[model samples]
Target: MRWVALTAVAPVAWGANYYVTHEFLPPDSPFYGAALRALPAGLVLLGLCRQRPRGAWWWRSAVLGLLNVSVFFVLVYAASQLLPTSIASTVMAVSPLAMMLIAWTLVAERPGIAHLAGAAIGLGGVCLTLLTGTAGVSMPGVLASVAAMLVSSFGHILTKRWNAGTDVLASTAWQLTAGGLFLLLVAAAVEGPPPSLSTSALLAFGYVTLVATALAFAAWFIGLRYLPAGTVGLVGLLNPVTGVLLGTAVAGEVLTVQQLCGLALVLAGVVLGQPTRAGRRGGSRTPLQPAPDKSAAREFSTRNPL
Candidate 1:
């Protein structure tokens, strides 16, 4: 449950990010936007972890970085620019089922019936929340959002499969840093120069980098370390829930009674899919271990004194 709560932070921050990016960030230069967000956040986390990738982690970091950070961030930015907050987040709501399927295939984590039901109910709620004929839909935006979902599902599950006994912070930092560097090179080549930032844009990037990217990914990876992928995915239903409420509160969008019901259903799905005590004991096949070095072990203990 503690892990569930921590995991919930990622989706909530991401939900708010759709609104922030759509409203404040530059719309045109997604590569620069993604690079800026990933690099700064990666550097901050790397500063804390003070560890570099080892052996397979070097290539693993690059692969996960490309899938999870570079391409994922760019596509998400494009989708946020092209779609409304609620709609964009609702599209992402499908990730729970996707993650479950990918985890089953990639990591042998079979989905429980409860998880399947929760996914169905949660997805139905997301539909009810967004299928109202009020917002205009973009096919390209939908494609981008769907692409982001698939890429992230595969990347995250691959992380789970490969990250057995690895330090979450250090590995996450490596992925982010590698991805950020990749994005910077690509952005330089294609986008000519970085976009100018207004004060609002700077603040927006700060929030996106620190809260949404760094804190959110850390919390999310922590959850993946401790919980089943299906459970973590169900918790992610909060992304759309937060997006809808944020839209109503901040964007002056009206919250229909149907959306309220959808929110309830989403919450219900999340709660329903929580791992029981027995499940938690048995479901997590991999046990966490030290970071394969005395210095990293000391740093991890120093930083996480819990």
Candidate 2:
């Protein structure tokens, strides 16, 4: 139940990301915004944790950081600049599909027909939502966004597979720290000095760093501890759904009848794809072993005292 609540929090935070980026950050300098958002948040989290991950954990952290933070943020921000939020988000809606493919290939975890059909139907709704909007879509932007989402999806699956037994807070802190350092380097080389700060930009930065990066990821990791990778992936559809609805209601973006139909389809598909408690017990699923208890922590310290 705690995990379910934690998982539910991730999409709401992610949905707000679009609003922050679009309304607050300067459209011309996306990489700069990405860097500001990721690096600072990572540093803060790392400082708070103060435990350096060692050996293979370092490599694991770096890999997760690159996929989840560096690539995902940069590509999504750049794509947003080139395309409408709706179109960019619609492309991102394909992440569940990518996650499904990765799980089946890597873990031999297959979804039932209902899951597949629901994902397809939801994707169709996303397409309709994009088509109904008045803004012209950019093919390059759409492709980039889709690619970024696929990469992020893979990272999420890897987190479930590799870090299932690690402390959620510690594992997340390491990934964010490493990923943030990488982004800082990218920003220095590509974007030069950060842009002049504005109040709205600062707010956006804080929201991205503190709320989106720190809190959102904490919740996400906790949720993944309980849910299947594919189920968690499907929940990502809410990110775009919330973005579109908020864009329309708050930003006064137009929503046509087609978009309404699309929203309905997406909602229906998500409902159909959700896993019931009974299914979780009886279904052929990957077992997510919980992290070690306090006794194991004590044993590790006693065995390898620094």
Candidate 3:
């Protein structure tokens, strides 16, 4: 339950991030924006952890970095710029299903009946909230958001698979640092110089870097360390919930009674998917457990932790 609460922090921070990016950050410089957000946050965590990737972790970190940070960040930035905060965040709610399927295939964590049902209920709520018909939807933004969801879902499950014995902070820092540096190089080549920042933009970047990227990723990975991927993904339902409420409160988006009801359903789904003590005991082992088999890949991963 404490892990559930801590995991909730990531999506909530990410939810607020949509509004901040849409309202304050430079829209035309997504590459630079992503690079800036990831790099500083990575450096901060690296400073704290004071450890670098060793052995196969170097390549693993690079791959996860590309999927989770480099590409996903740019797509999310594009979606945030092109769509309303509520809509952009709602699109991401579909990631629970995606994560479930990916986890089933990649890590052999079968989706429980409760998890599937919760995803269904949560997705239905997403539709109800998203179909407000008040704001015009952008097709490109929707595509970008969906792409971000799939990429992130796969990357996150892969993180869980390989992060068995690693310090979550160190591994997260490595991915962010690798991804940020890659983005920086690419942004320099394609986007020209980094964009100039206004005072508001700098402040927005600070919040995005420290809170959303660094703290959120650490909390999220920590949850993955303890909980099943399906459970963590369902907890992510709060991302859109926060986006919708924040949109209503700060962005003056309409909060219909229907949307409020949808919020209830979404929260219910989140609650439904939480791990009971019985569930934890009866279900497949989380990544924190050592594998029973002495497979080469398992042995290799064990030898080169994180």
Q: Which candidate is the best by TM-score?
A: 3
- Clashing residue pairs in all predictions, respectively, total 0, 0, 0
Ranking by lDDT: 3, 1, 2
Deviating ranges (above 4 Å) for candidate 3: 281-306
TM-scores for candidates 1 onward, in order = 0.92, 0.89, 0.93
lDDT of all predictions:
0.87, 0.74, 0.88
Residue ranges of candidate 2 with Cα displaced over 4 Å: 133-135, 279-283, 288-306
Give a tens-digit lDDT track for model 3, residues 1-306: 888899999999999999999999999999999999999999999898887777788899999999999999999999999998888998999999999999889888887878888899999898898787765789999999999999999999999888876778888999999999999999999999889999999999999999999999999998887788889999999999999889889999888988888888888889888898755523545553435333324433333222
> What are the per-residue Cα lDDT tens digits for candidate 1 across 1-306?
788898999999999999999999999999999999999999999998888886677898999999999999999999999988888888888999999899889877878888888899998898888777775788899899999999999999988877665678888898999999999999999999789999999999999999999999999988887788889999999999888888889988788888888888888888888988666422444333212445434434334411
> Candidates sorted by TM-score, descending order?
3, 1, 2
Question: lDDT by residue for model 2 over 1-306, one digit each (tens)?
Answer: 445556767777777777667777888776677777777877776676666776577788899999898888888787767765556676777777888788777655676666677789889988888776465677788888888888888888778666644567777877887787888888888878878988878877888889988888878877676666666666777777887787788877777889888888877877777777655522545554444445435422212111
Cα lDDT of candidate 2 equals 0.74
Give residue 147's lDDT in candidate 1 (0 to 100). Answer: 98
How many clashes does the backbone of model 1 have? Answer: 0
**lDDT at 257 for candidate 2?**
88
TM-score of 3: 0.93
